[model samples]
Target: MNGKIIGGFLVLSALVAGAAMYYLQVYAFYRPVEVSSPAAAIRLVSLGGVQEAMLTSDFEAIDADSSPLRFRGCFVTPMTLAMLSETFETYEDPTPLNAPPWFGCFDAERIGADLETGAALAFLSEKNIHPGVDRVVAVYPDGRAYAWHQLNESAEK
Candidate 1:
């Protein structure tokens, strides 16, 4: 009886551990992938006196067959993510379907590509489309540009 009970308990524990690991891996799939670039290595000084910096290149920009431009950046801070959510609410157009208010329409595939690549900075800065942040820049395979916000001389801590 003692041997049977111990065997059952061990099996139950293993099952539970396996389930937990599976859940964590699935949840982490949506999380941003780490990226690296010289342009991504800079500190942002906000008007609110907040010092923000990127620890890794968590953003990317990729081209999708459907959209003219796609924007994707990591949601590292709640504030930055909240700002993006707000942009979707106020800036997104209703009739065109997935069109950025200031920029033209893009397909979901392109958006997904942007998310995969990390081009959020460039999308906002181009054409002087300011979303009211510290800096907005876009990098291409060829070159990079500071489209909106200026950079400050602060190292990433």
Candidate 2:
């Protein structure tokens, strides 16, 4: 009886430890990044491919008043990631998602409806248009974007 009780306790403890580790990792790696200001947001986005980016005013109604700058892309590149990390201010996010292959994530104070809508759709879309999207970007005022296709790795390995 004593041996059986000890074994059960050990098993339970191991399971609990495993779960705690997973929770911590998910939150740490996938937390939203904090930005210092709107300029930082624009500067970060500018470093990436801007050919597909649309002006917030032209794309949506919420950002009509914010016309001091221009936006041109939805995603950022490795060349810009390091520069962006330096440009933006990030902190510990209270909540994070549980997705596999988490590359990184950040929170933006300002963003347009189009980007938010598109990113959310990508996350919940039926078709896997952007597979390997492990990281997420939580936009303020209810917006979100997830990063797919990590740049650290090569396409043809």
Candidate 3:
């Protein structure tokens, strides 16, 4: 009947729209960030308000131009937490943003929990890296580090 056909069409349309939305959000906009890109640099803010680059290796990153908060990075730093804490301004509150599962390196939940338990230390990578977003970098004792851009207090207000 006509009613049945119309209902089926509506259901089909919704399913198609859902699939497209998922694809765009999870895959379309993101691109592998190259080592040469500024986003891949692991720099922290020094106590004197200067941004200093740290010694980082095995860097892997992903970014999406669609939003400033979409930048995420994973790397290893030779600098110990003791030296880093002494050298840079520590971030009082650090919350990491989740990356797509395909990326596999940056796990926001694990990083956040580590920060809560003192298993990792978070540093202010760059304040106001975007208009109202701050770049935060959290490092574990084993030299594993992850970076992400998050909304600052100003932006949250």
Kindly give the stretch of ten consecutive residues in candidate 1 with the minimal lDDT sum. Answer: 88-97
- For residues 1-157, write the lDDT of model 2, one tens digit per residue: 9999999999999999999998764443333223333322322122232212211211110111222111112343332323333444321221232233332232222222434443222221111122322122322322323322221112223
Instruction: Report the error of model 1 at residue 129, Å.
Output: 22
What's the count of clashing pairs in each model shown?
9, 7, 0
Q: For residues 24-125, write the lDDT of model 1, one tens digit per residue.
A: 533322322134533344344333434345232324322222322223232232234334333322111111123222232224345435435654323222
Q: Where's the lowest-lDDT run of ten residues in candidate 2?
A: 57-66
lDDT of 2 at 10: 100
Q: Model 3 TM-score?
A: 0.97
Which candidate has the top score in TM-score? Answer: 3
TM-score of 1: 0.22
Residue 40 accuracy (lDDT) in model 1: 40
lDDT of 3 by residue, 44-138 (tens): 99999999998999999999999999999999999999999999999988999889989999889999999999999999999999999999999
Error of 2 at 153 (Å): 6.2
